[model samples]
Target: MPDRRDLDIGELMTAFDAVVRANASLMTQLSSRAGVHDTALRALVLVSDTGYSTPTEVAGFLGLTSG
Candidate 1:
């Protein structure tokens, strides 16, 4: 295979920064909503961050049960 040396660190950093900023904005909005405590918000964040999770796993981590 030909040498693959094609990647832009600057662009990657920019995209990462944008994602971080957007996540922060959404987190603030969600936190302001009623009936949502820190634990719930954290569970949501963890699920979103990890991209996929089972209810049992999340519940176990959050000290909740899969109902």
Candidate 2:
């Protein structure tokens, strides 16, 4: 984990948001080439990062409908 003592919470969130945006942009391009939806790639990334995930968690992360 990154050392949080030297960074402000807001600054960290801003940085994380920026990184997520950049990654999303990249995922869009890659998904287009690979013939997959960007959301699929994003969900896979979220699951991969956490090592394990549930349907509810993935749905929430991807803003997918649970119904």
Candidate 3:
């Protein structure tokens, strides 16, 4: 049988509120360790997903600059 504690964690992780909270907590921890602003991590994630993006494009999409 699946461990009850593991099942509880899985259910909690699947919850939208739990997922968002967990993501925010992890991002905070990661940004602190990486020595970069949280927005920088967000921008990196956005840039990595789009192969054809440029700096201007990314800035515009990220609202860091006027499009």
**Best by lDDT, which number?**
2
- Model 2 lDDT tens row, 1-67: 6677656887988999999899879999999998989899878889999999998999999888756
User: What is candidate 2's TM-score against the reference?
Assistant: 0.60
Each model's lDDT comes to 0.78, 0.88, 0.82
What lDDT tens digits, residue by residue, belong to model 3 across residues 1-67? 9999999988876897877889889888898899998778867877788757788877887688854
Error of 1 at 16 (Å): 0.5
Question: Of 1 and 2, which scores higher on lDDT?
Answer: 2
Ranked by lDDT, the better of candidates 2 and 3 is 2
For this target, which candidate reaches the highest TM-score against the unseen true structure? 2
Candidate 3 Cα errors over 4 Å, as ranges: 1-14, 54-67
Each candidate: RMSD: 7.5, 6.4, 7.1
What's the lDDT of the predicted structure labeled candidate 2? 0.88
Candidate structures ordered by TM-score, highest first: 2, 3, 1
From the highest lDDT down, the ranking of the candidates is 2, 3, 1
Work out the TM-score per prediction.
0.47, 0.60, 0.57
